[model samples]
Target: MRIAVFIKKTTFHKGYGGIETQNKSLCEGLTKRGHEVFVFSPKLELDRNSIVENGVRYIFVSCAFKMDGFFGERNKDNWFTRSAQRFEEEHAKQPFDVVIGQSSAAVGVIKRKWELNIKVVSVAHGTIISEYKTFLNNMVGLREWIKIVSNTGYVLKSFFSRQREYVHGSEKVVAVSNFVKSALVDETFVDAQKVEVIHNGVDGGARPIQAHPNNQPLKLVYIGRLERSKGLQNLLKAISRLNNVTLSVIGDGPYLPQLARLVKSLHLSERLIFVGRVAPEKIPEILSQANVFVYPSLRYEGFPMAVVEAMFCGLPVIASNIGGISDALENGTTGYLVKSGIIADLRDTIREFVNKPDLIRKMGDAAYAKAQREFNLDTMLSKYEKILEDVVK
Candidate 1:
C-alpha cells in the first residue's frame, strides 16, 4: 500500500519531538514491511524542501497562512498553499492510496483529499473539547485578547467542523487514547463508530537497572518540555520534601529558568539537576541510567511518549493520574499514580518507592513486560497498516 503521512514537523533521530519520532518510526517500519510511505511535514529543517530518509521520501511544504491562528501560538507562516500545490504536482507522478494526517493538520489533509481522491485518516493528538474548556475560561474578560481569543475559539470551532468534514470525507479517525476518544465523542460530538483508539508506541526497549549496586545516588529522570502544565514545580516541591532522591531533568523550554529558581528557593539545588535539552537517541541510555521516572504533568495530556519510554527502560514510574496515564501505567501494578497537582501525594509516593525498593523491581518488571507485550513499535505500525489497508480496499 502507498501511504502519505502528514505531520507539522520532522527531525532526525536527535532533534525530533514525540510525534515526529513516532512518525519516523512508523514511516521506517511501514517501508521495511514492503509498503511505500511518503512523509509530508514542514520544510523547517530542510534546505531544498525535501529529503529522503531510510528509503522513504519526505516532502516538505510551506504553509501559506500563519498557523498562529490555528494553533493559538504565533509561528512563522509555512506556505501551505504552495505545499499543497507542490503535492498536487507530485501526485501526478505517483498517487498515494491513503493519506494519514497527524494532530491538527486537518485543513491540509482535507485539501489533499480533494485533490487525490484517497481516503484520509486523521490521528487526533487530543481534540479541544471539555478538557480544553479551561483554556476558554482563561481567554475571557481580557481586552485586546479579543483577536487571539477569538482565534482560539475559531481554532476549536474549526477543529470540530473540520473533524466532522474529515470524518465524512475519509475512512477513519484514530484517537491517540481512550481519553482522547472521549474528548472527541462527548466533547466534540464525533460519531463513536468513526473513531478508534491506537495508543502511541515506545521506540526502544528498557531493561531494569540495578540500583544501590555501588552506592550511587538514586537517579530520577523527567524528560520533555519544562512547561508549568507539565508539573515541574510540583516535582521540585515534592523532591524538597523527600530525602536521598536525586532528580535529573532532561529537556528545556520557556519555564526552565523558573523551574531552576523554584529548586533553588526550595533549597533543592543539591537534589535536582536540570540537564536542559539532550538528543532523543540518548534518552534511552539516560532512562537506563535512572532509578525512577517521574511525569507529574497537571495538564490533560493526550498520552505521554516519555512515560512509555521510561516503562520500556524498566524504570519505576510515578505520574499524575489523568487522561490515558492510568491506562498506560496500570497504577500500583506497573507504576505509581499520584493525584494531579498534589505535591504531598507526590512526595508520599516518592517516599514509598524509596523505602520499599523491592516494589521497584516488581513494578519495573511489570512495566517491561507491559512494554514488550502491549507497546511494541512493530505492533503499533502493524495496527496502522491494517487500518490503512482496510481504508484503501
Candidate 2:
C-alpha cells in the first residue's frame, strides 16, 4: 500500500515528543511491512526540502494561510494547506492510497476530499475541550497567557469550522488513549462509534534491569520536556523529605532555570542530577539506571510515551492520576498513581518505594510484562496497518 502521512512537525524538525515518536515509529513500521510511506511536515532538520530516512520519505512544506474567521472555517491555511499542495505535487508522480493526518495537519486534504478523491484518517492527540478545561493546571505568567490565547483561537476554529471535517470528512479517527476517546466523544461530541482507542506505544523490547544495590541510594528518573506545568519543582518538594532517594532529570526546556532554582532552594542539588538531552538510544540505559520513573505533570496529556518507555525498561512508575497515566499504570500492581498536584500524595507514594524497595522489583516485573503484552510498538503498528487496509478496501 502507498500512504501519505501529514503532521505539523516531525522528529526531524522538532525534538522527540509522544506524537512525534508515534508518527516516526508508524511510518517506519509501515515501510517495513512493504508499504510505501511519504511524510509531510512544515520543516525538517536538513537543508533540503525532502529526505528519505528509515525507508520513508519526508517532505518539508513552507506554506501558511489563515481561516476565513478566527473561530470558524474548516478549510486550508496553517500547515495543512502548504503540505497538501506539496502532496498534490508528489501524487502526480505516483498516487497515494490514503492519508493519515495528525490533529489539524491534514485539514486541507480533508476539505478537498471530493476533489482529491482520497480517504483521510485523523489521529487526534487530545480534544480542544480538554485543553480548555486544564489550561490553568499546567500554565502561568505572561508567556503562558500568550500561548493560551493562541490556543484559544485554534479551539474556537476546531469547534466552529474544522470539527465538521474531523467528524464527517475522515474515514476514521484514532485516539491515543481511552481517556482521549472519552474527551472526543463526551466533550467534543464526536461520534463515539467513529473514534477508535489505540493507546500510544514505545519502540523498545521489554528489558528488565538488574537488581538494585543495597548500599546505593534509590534512583528515580523523570523524562520529558522540563516545563513548569510538568511540576518538576513540585517533584523536588516531594522528594525533599527523603534523603535515600536521588533523582535523574532527563531532557531540557525553557523551565530549566526555574527547576534548578528549586533544586537549590530545597538543598536537593546533590541528590538530583539534571542529565539534559541524550540520544534516543541512550533512553534504555537511563531507564535501566533508575529504580523508578516519576511523571509529575499537572497539565493535560494524551498518553505519555515516557511512562510507556519506562515500563518497557521494567521500571515501575509513580505519576499524576490524569490523562492516560491512570489507564497505563495498573495502580499498586504495575505501578502507582497519585492525585495530580498533591505533593503529599506524591511524596507518600515515593516513600513507599524507598521504604519497601522490594515493591520496585515486583511491580517493575509486572510493568515490563504488561508493556510487552499490551502496548508495544509492534501491536500499535499492526493495528494501524489493519485499519489502513480496511479503510482502503
Candidate 3:
C-alpha cells in the first residue's frame, strides 16, 4: 500500500514532540511491513528535497511561510494546506491508498480530499479545547495570559469549524487513547462509532532489570518537556517535603528557570538535578539508572509516550490520575497514581515507595511485564496497518 502521512513537522526537521515521535514510529513501522510510506513536512535544512531513511521516504515541501512553533500556529499563511496541494500536484502520477493525518495536518488533508481522491484518517492525539483550557489555567504572567487569550480565539474557531471538519470529514478517526476518543466524541460531537482507541506503543525488550540498592538514595526521574502543566513544580514541592529521594529531570522547556527558582526558594537545590534534553536513544540508559519514574502532569494527556518508555525500561511510574495515564497504568499493579495537584498525596505516594524500597522493584517488574504485553511496538503497528487498510477498502 502507498500511504501518505501529513504532519506539520517531524523529528526529521528537528521537531521534538510526542506527535512527531508517533508519526515517525508509524511511518517506519509501515515501511517495515513492506508498505511504501511517504511523509510530507514543511521544508527544513535537508540536503535534498526528499530522503529515504529506515525504509520510509520523507518529502520536504517548500512553502512561502515556515509553519514553525507549537501547533504550527505561527503559520498565518496556511503553509501546511498549500504544501499539501503542492505535494499532491508533484506526485500526481502516483495516487496514495490512504492519507494519514496527525492533528493540524488533518485540517489540510480534509481540505484537499477531493483533489487527492484518497481515504483520509485523522489521528487525534488530544483536543485543542482541552489544551487551550490547560494553557489558560497555567498562565504565568500578563504576556502569557495575552498570548493564550489571542490563541483562544483560534482554538474556539477550530473547535467550532475546522476541528469539526477534520473529525467528521475523515473516513475514520484514530484516537491515541480511550480518554482522547471520549474527548473527541463528547466534546467535539464526533461520531463515537468512527473513533477508534489505539494506545501509543513503544519499543521494549532492551535493558535487563537493574537492582536498586537499599543503601542508595531513591532515584526518581521525570522525562518530558519542562512546562508548567507538566506538574514539575508540583513534583519539586512534593520532593522538597521528602528527605532522601533525588530527582533527575531529563527534558528542557521555557519553565526551567522558574522551576530552578522554586528549587532554590524551597532549598531543594541538592535534591534536584536537571539533565536538559537528553537524546532519545539515551533514555533507556537514563531510566536504567533510576528506580522510579515520575510524571506529575496537571493537564489532560493523550497517552504520554515518556511514561510508557519508562515502563518499558523496567521502572515503576508515579503519575497523576488523569486522562490516558489511568489507562496506561493499573494502580497498585504497574505503579501508583496520585490525584492531580494534591501535593500531600503525591508526597505520601513517594514516601510509600521510599519506605518500602522492595515494592519499587516488584512494581518495576510488573510495569515491564505490562509494557511487553500491552504496549509493544509491533502490536500497535499491526493495528494501525489494519485500520489504514480497512479504511481504504
Cα-lDDT of candidate 1: 0.76
lDDT of 3 by residue, 1-393 (tens): 988888878886653788888788888888888999988877756666788899888888776444323455446446656666766774687877888888757566677678677688888999887787677767787889668756876777777766787898899999999988988898778779999988888977455366467777899999989889999999999988888899999988888999999999999888889999887889899989898999999888999999999999889999999888888999998899999888999999998888888888789899998999999899899889889889988
Candidate 1 C-alpha lDDT tens digits along 1-393? 877777777764235666776777778888999988887776664567677888789887755434444553233354445555566676778887888887655455575576567677888767665345434433434553655666566667656565566555556888878988887787556679988888888666757876543245567889988777788888888888777789999998877888888877999887777887887778888888888899998777787888889989988799998777776888788888999888999999988877777777788888888988888887788889888888888
> What TM-score number comes out for model 1?
0.89
lDDT of each: 0.76, 0.83, 0.84
Candidate 2 lDDT tens digits, 142-242: 88787877777777777766765665678899988888888777756767888888888777744777646666688999999988778788889999998
Clashes of 1: 10
Error of 1 at 212 (Å): 3.5
Best-first order by TM-score: 2, 3, 1
Better of 1 and 3 by lDDT: 3
**Model 3 C-alpha lDDT versus the unseen true structure:** 0.84
User: Looking at candidate 1, what is the lDDT of residue 57?
Assistant: 92
